[model samples]
Target: MRIAYLILCHGQPAQIRRLVMALPPSSPIFIHVDARTSAAVHAEIHQLAYLRAHIHFVPRHRCFWSGYGIVKATNQLIISALASGEAFDRATLLSGADYPIKSQEHINAFFENAGDAEFIEAFPLHAPNRWSNHEGLYHGASRVDWFHVRFRSRAWRSPWRRRLPLGYEPWGGGQWWTLTRPALELIADVARKHPALPRFFRNVFLPDESYFQTLLGNSRFRGAIAGDDLRLVIWDRPEPPYPAILKARDIECLAESDKLFARKFDLYRNPEIYELIDARFLRRS
Candidate 1:
């Protein structure tokens, strides 16, 4: 089975190159570097080996850690990968800082057995309209316009905040996903036909965590496997903006999780993570 690995890098082109080199040559790689990043780093990325032909430099935009830009970027990557007309069985989205925990052979074997089962966990979301108050959970003149407006400021509960016939449910995890071709095609079709939904979601807080999850959950592929493929991550002592970086000491956890990937690691803080996973998890070239 072929896999299209997509990574979103906000910084550190060197680390991205290293990770890309570790994967098998047959596996296609696609990257979306944040458009707002430094010009030097962006240039350095395109210069990396095997990248000139596959890389996609998405428009630089301010990505909100808790907003919709993240989702928008992911969708763009998926579309680009499919448009390549390559023989790809699945698509996996990752971060610049993440590392795979399994060998290429093992990963290929795993997907060979996983068919028709979507690995994404999805759910529904409903919330009250809050437009009456100056500061509302959502601000807009009407329900249709609420998702379109830029959230400038949240008043102390706006007049528009009102309960609707909706209740938000749990969506998918924020990081790491492998979607089948059928699923990807479905999402692409939905995205084109319903432009407003995606735009509306883009205005929502943490749309990455909601947009795809909501669509898949409401689609015909809802009954598939929710989560599998071992991926290890250590959150901060109390958990900060990202998960805890994996260190040499965490190598044992990485070996034991049986996951395909683990995340939220920084190469600068713990360069050993690279060596550790390369030597212990993946085969030496």
Candidate 2:
């Protein structure tokens, strides 16, 4: 079965090229480079002849951290891959700077074991039951607002909701995910059937976290999920909104997670992380 790598980035070309070279040539790559980024970024993508055919430049738009754009960009990627008609077996969505922490051999083996199941690790995030106390939040907070207050809930928003074949679950975690073709199709179908759904979800807090999780959890294929979004990221001092940059000290822990990937490595301070990954995890030539 084929595996496709999808990365969304607003970074330098040399860095992205280095990442492209790190993966197998046969594995398809799709990138959504924010158009508003500098020209050098686009040029770098062109330099990587390997990704030229698979590269997809999404329409340039300002992505709100808690808005619909993130999901829209992802949906665009899914549509592009399906339209490519390549019949891939699995798909992994990654960020521009995120790197894989597992060897290709291990990654392939994991997917082999998880056939037909969607690998979108998630945790329970109850709503109103937990959010009702917040001063600004309303009794009927839209799913979008959970992005900011999910961790503070006092009780399950509703456990029975999670029991349905298509139940609701809290959606907050790393944006990366590995989806089988069937799961991808399921997501696409939902997007198609409900024209207003994407817009409806765009306003939700942390929609990226919930949009996929809630949709899949409420689908007939919910049972097929692997239940963990696998990636290691350390938050910066004071716990900034973005994750901390990876470093040498974090390498050993990341290597041991046995998860498929780790993310947010510092391009400068963590070149060694890349080297360590190349030498240990992926064994890139």
Q: Which candidate gets the maximum lDDT versus the true structure?
A: 1
- Looking at model 1, report the run of 10 residues with the lowest lDDT sum: 156-165
lDDT of 2 by residue, 1-285 (tens): 568887777766777777777665568777777655678767677567655455545454445555566778888788777777666798889887878777777777887887577788644445434334544333223344332323322211322111212334444444679888778887898889876666556445556766787777667767877776677767645545568777777778886686777777666756777887788778775
TM-score of each model, in listed order: 0.82, 0.80
Candidate 1 lDDT by residue in tens digits, 1-285: 988888888788778987887776777787788766788988888776455444444445455565566777788888888887667888888888878889989989998997777766443333332223423342322322233334432212223432211332324434457899888898898889877667556455445755676667667877874644245667545656557767778888788787788886778878887887888778764
Candidate 1 clash figure, as a count:
25
Best by TM-score: 1
Off by over 4 Å in 1: 49-61, 125-172, 228-230, 239-241
Cα displacement (angstroms), candidate 1, residue 130, comes to 24
Clash count for each candidate, listed in order shown: 25, 8
Clashes of 2: 8
Displacement of residue 271 (Cα, Å) in model 1 is 0.8
